[model samples]
Target chain A: MSETPTLESLQAALDAQQAIFEMHQSMNMEVFYWWCTAIMFLIHAGFLAYEMGASRSKNALAAGIKNILALVVIIPTFYLFGWWIYNAFPGGFIPAEASAALPWSQSMGPDAKDLGTGVFWAAFALFGATTGSILSGAVIERIRVSAFLILTIVLGSGVWILGGAWGWHPDGWLLTKLGYHDVGASGVVHAIAGFFTLGVLLNLGARKGKFIDGVAQTISPHSLPMTLIGLMLIIVGFFGFLGGCIIFNGGDTGWTTIYGNPTNLSAFAFNTLMGFSGGIIGCYVATRDPFWTMSGGLVGIISVAAGLDLYDPGLAFIIATCMGVAAVYFAKLLENLGIDDAVGAVAVHGFTGVVAVILVGVFAAGTPNVNGLPPISFMGQLTSAGVMIALGFLPGYGLSLLLKKLNMLRVPEKCEELGIDEVEILAKPYPEAGVPAIAASDVPNKLANTELQGA
Target chain B: MGTSITTWENVSAYFTFADNPMALGLFVAGATVIVVGLIRSIIKHENEAFKQHK
Candidate 1:
């Protein structure tokens, strides 16, 4: 009467459905990582454009080239050794299976068996590049490109990665021993970069004409619109950066943090948006300047980043608002101290990063360490923060001082007077704008000028 | 096998090694590299001074 399915047929149907489900889950995680890696590229684009705009028209190209070269150098270097450093240094001494990340490793190339490592490495490389970019803007119009590349390699590939291995990695000594937790690298990437740049700034000195007779001068950007647009691009890129922070677990569990702590994109989205808006409001209240206003959005996010996984959304907003205001003022304080931070990288990244690290202790104390070494504590984060600052600042300061002694740190004063673009690049970003259309000898005098105006 | 939710405690428990000599060696090696890089940069600069901008 009916063509009923036999036990064998039913079993086969069930197996087929299970296989399809498994395949879909794996594919989704792969695509997710790829998407995050793609988004992180925006941070670099934003840095390039923003620094170019902040620089004088004469130095725009120099600023831009630095960014491009840093990206190029850091990428290859990261592949060769930086990846190994991350995998190996969790114990703060030796890398575990560090050879596995070497260029000769089979997994280093396309392998059907391993789908996640490449994309994960891509995302981390972007993070490394970002640390270099943060330093790029602060030192623009003055730093030697060669020195920048060397420092970028050191910081991006060596120092920052070491910090990550010690703290950010799942098996890091900080997490295992001190119960340290930083889900968003507020301390690992931002603070280290920010403070390291501070060290460089101390050695590199101020931009020429930035301070005169013990008073600070505002060296304005050539194009305000360009800077604004660049910042917006950075925000777009940040979506990718934060996405990379997550570890995608296949099947129903969905996502977790790099430390294997349970979390969701929904929580991240809520906190990120709230913090952004709160920062904007805080910045707008203090300084109506569009630059700081937009920057508040970034500060807000950093302020909330340390506790992004666990904070109430409203708390995220409040913390972001306070930090947004605080960041602007902190930049002012550094300016008062005669530091020439071209784009407030230190305040935005360093100060906010430190605050975020400490705030986690205050706000998120007793939160279970995702790796379960010890509970989150104020002392633990404080210790971790101090160690990170020392780790970052010492090498940066030491190396920059050595470069300074060698006279290879900053462009000569003459170059600053003429601009790096004119001296180094021998090209113009806006040749037409910089040079006049008519020849000096062909000038028609006032009568011709009147006629031209009439026409 | 299904994925496992790894808490901080669970992760810490999993990596049960009491000591890591490699990590200590890395710290020393890293310090050495930074110092060497700085000195090397100085030497390189002395041998071939970069052209001043322009």
Candidate 2:
């Protein structure tokens, strides 16, 4: 005769089975995270296209290649150390116990048991790549490839990630000590990238023929269609970016209280559209130019992106409109200061990010932190924004100045005169398929033949 | 843990069909082809850039 199992033993067995099932479910969700990550990667393609289109025909290939190379350098560097920096240095500003988030951590690699680290790391890497790319546009026509590459590593894998650790991370000192909140990286990504571009611009100086008798001259884009396509891609990628940040895996609650529930997809969608519309209209009214108008949409979203999850749609629209109008003036101000930003990146990303952070204080006032800290306040937000600007600008400017002193920041004047395309790039973006090749010696003969034919 | 085919069989049943083996193989082949095509295009672009410089 067999003895029946006790009730306590059966309950224990059931608990063990439940735990195993939950682990499997978590792993499945992690697989979906990778798929979402791939979608977000499309943003880089958009950035590449948009930046290339905005550059002059002579500089298009150089600009495109530069942005692409930034990604190449940034990805490996980020994988090796950047993600760990974010996790480890969150308490750097305030003296909290340091946590080890080394690359060799078990959660970082493929494991059937733990599942969140890889995708989370990837998401931050994409942010780093974007930070590097935004600076590409500002110094396009003149920056030395080597200098820019160095800057890319510092800003992309170094500075921006540091900002994330300080402000955007849950355990970041800015958050823990100052009650800092940057939901979608207005301060961490856009502000830092913009400021870094400004720092480099101060040392690299303006492009050849950019200024005339102390006045800035406008340089038109090579292709408008390509620029438009790039902008649209960025808009689409941003949706996934903002959405991905909200992911958490606790219990029966789907996308709930563990992470702050400031807003949902619908809220973001509504605010994004309104902000874009308002920005475009405002920019058009200010500049009466299609280029600035399109840029207005971008500036608008960036301005409100920090607080989109918290702001009402109407507030987002108003704030975006104000930011767009302000950006045009700021771009003009930078130009007058002899800082030539080819794509207005400083105004669009840097200035607008600061503004967005400040606006969050107003809109999110009295809102409780996810961790039950004090409500969002204007002073707290201002202090956080100031820290972001200082951290990004001071180090970047110092590094760039040092690079300039080493004579490595800008290309030779001869290369600038001949165009970086024919000099250093050594490749023509467009190869003539039908045109006959004529050597310098043969040019006279060809001209004579054409003249004789005309006679 | 039980060294049983119960879980394995249940999972396989979802994918099992009379023509599934061939169809799955063909699908994998198609994906590979598409990926190869994209790689070819990227390589062509780079080659053209190199040729222009030369």
Candidate 3:
């Protein structure tokens, strides 16, 4: 026979349970971020493959190395300053209260008192590295490795992090005052990188013999299949990149957007997939070329990214489809204007990113924001798009111009004529193909003098 | 005097950590790591969130 419990004893038991629950919640949070960082690496792998395949055989190895270096070099630099910018500037240029985010802070490293900080930094570092990779692809085959690394450091670790702080953070001015809502970072990540690449291209100029009599010439990929496969891998990596955008508040809070708006996983599932299909269809209908079709899938997702949290599935699909078509037109427009973006980075990322923000503003206007004082509106989104453009383009153009003036931006004309790999890398990409190493090999060995023969 | 809230349905089975101080510390440490991991996941994703059915 047992006696009835008193109220005080019940309270004691409940408190203990609450403590255990908090502990469990915190631990779950750490592990989730760790995996998010790990999966983000796949994005770099895909970019490496994609860029290398897009390049002439001689430049492939160098492209891969540049991507790898970006992945490795960003970790420390981001730790030193990039993560701090995210923590510091949510209020604007003036630093906010973020002692915990300081590089020397115990919480910034492995510390028993805090669990979330290190993983957060690592994941953010990956995000920063991604911005570098975007700029990396556009300038490949012509850029000096040293100059490229410096630009990568500035963009990946310096510039993009500022955009993130101002636009992506919870306490960001873009959100609190302007009612800016970019749940999927269409403006911050994609647009900023795209514009930055545009700036670099202005300085870097078109690849040699790419234009004759003010008309563009086609430069075919050595392995179209490899480029397409790499694009598919990038699509797979996007699943993880998208996963890192929301907060996993477990108990009373459930989940919320980075801006602290109501959301659920269902919205992501419907939109991301539908958007991909719509983009592919739109691209295929617009251009019969397989390469542009794959790019359309990426364009579609970005087009809908700004409103991913609230869009009806059908609307997302339709918006993505339109953007997919627009991406091709945008690319052609840039080409006509004499801008040589190697992978259509400007149209697919920069132009579509600007359009995506505007689309969401029109479609998602009057949508409630956190605290409801500000609501999503066209003007606010347009302003944010402008900011993203300036943030990306100004720094990109200025730094690249400086590099050019110093003669540190492009490789020597002779080296470029022979292939970057032959000047920089030592391995032969297609050793047995016998297709003439002078055009594509990494080394000036036996293959350099050899020529193709009848099959 | 207060009676225990140890109802038949509510009482949890004890883990060894509750009895050993060192083990309890380890439990908290492990929990910290896990929570940190989850926070990293939640914040980085352009996520699809699941609202637990209350």
Candidate 4:
């Protein structure tokens, strides 16, 4: 009994197909972000090696421990508050309506209805942790592990995520009001972290011999090879990070940036490679130093990161080269001002991010954000840059200042001279390097190692 | 709507968040991080402080 095809029947069948298509799209996005999270962990591993290699043999283990601890500590804190901040404060506070983002929300878990939130939340948590990694390198050797851990919590779970809520989120005021277009989080993550580290350094003081009688001296890395390898791993992680910055879907729909502007991984890959090379060239030309040269790759990517979804590969290279050169000179400028940023994080991440944010306006001006509410402009990015700097600097300065006054910020003076690994960790990084472990008996008020062992 | 956590019938049998035991479990983990970090700072600082009179 063949019945004439009715409009209702055709519509019903079409609706079923659309439902299947949408489900696949959601599943694909979830899977993509899951991998993105795994790849992003490489950034932390790279940071561990990079900072450890940068440290003198005495403090290498301490640097490794602090970096690892920051990674470990940030996870639970991010779960409790960082995710909530990202979802709730995107509308500039009051939470108006974000119960679904609450840690306690039924929707926050693996609900059959929503496949995206868990994976998306995991990716965002990794992004938040990267900000802590950026701060970790700069404060190595000199910072108290607990103090570093707390500051990592504050920055990773609190300050930087708030900036992300304002700039990175879709409904963020910066996006709605100013058309802020940081598709790669140049401002929210890198600049904020760099500025925050700067504020902390001003309070933490120079590592004892970093400055001598008003002159800055170079403290050589223990192993340049490890640092160079670690830098490449961070670049690889950033590729995954950039992949997460855009949305993917099934069917013929074009990949789009977080702001819904059409882009693809091809655009990201091209610009990342171009920018990475450009930074290396510029840094080698400027400093002729391997560490800065490797770091120039980071500077390059950050310099162009603001507009990765938009720039021509050639333009990205040129801009990255300029910023790479600028980062080295900027690091020197800060050094002159008595700020001792160990890995030039202040210049590499902070300075490059701010300039890249502003430069995107210069290059991509008049480009409309999603729905064309407002066009990108230099003023908009410049304004957002100011806010990011303040968000990073204020909490960093005030909280670290409190830590300093509490005598909990820097390592005890004697501890700094003896390597931190030997002083507190009790394990020598190099068994044959002849650095003796400091016994607790050396301190007048401290319990002796033998006494504790006897007990 | 599903509230029985021990039931194996469906995944939704567990309700998590806020006041739920699992949610509180997460909260306790976060609290431990904060407390342990503070304790470590204080102990390390006191253990190695230069003697006030010396």
What is the Å distance of residue A232 in model 1 from its true position? 1.0
Tens digits of lDDT, candidate 1, A319-347: 99989899999999999999999999999
Native contacts recovered, each model:
0.04, 0.00, 0.00, 0.05
Question: RMSD to native for every prediction?
Answer: 10.5, 10.6, 12.6, 4.6
Worst 10 residues of 1 chain A by lDDT: A439-448
| Per-residue lDDT of model 3, residues A1-455, tens digit only | 98798999999999999989988898888888778778888888888888999898988888888888787667767876788899899888899878766554435544444667777788789888888888988888888777787788888888888989988888788888888988887888889989999999999999887789999998877777877887888778777677777677767887788888878777887999998888888888999899889988889888998888989999999999988888999899988998888888888889988888888889998998877648899899999999999999999999999989987788777667767776656566777677675565434564545575332
Q: List the lowest-lDDT window of 10 residues for candidate 2 chain A.
A: A437-446
TM-score, cand. 1: 0.84
Docking class of 1: incorrect
lDDT of 1 at A427: 62
Winning model by lDDT: 4
Q: What is the lDDT, from 0 to 100, of the residue A55 in candidate 4?
A: 92
Q: What class would a CAPRI assessor give candidate 3's docking?
A: incorrect
lDDT of 2 by residue, A334-417 (tens): 999988998899998999998888888887877778666656788888988888888788877998899799876777776676
Off by over 4 Å in 2: A1-28, A93-100, A256-263, A433-455, B1-54
Q: lDDT (CA) for every model shown?
A: 0.82, 0.75, 0.80, 0.85
Candidate 2's interface RMSD, please?
Answer: 11.4
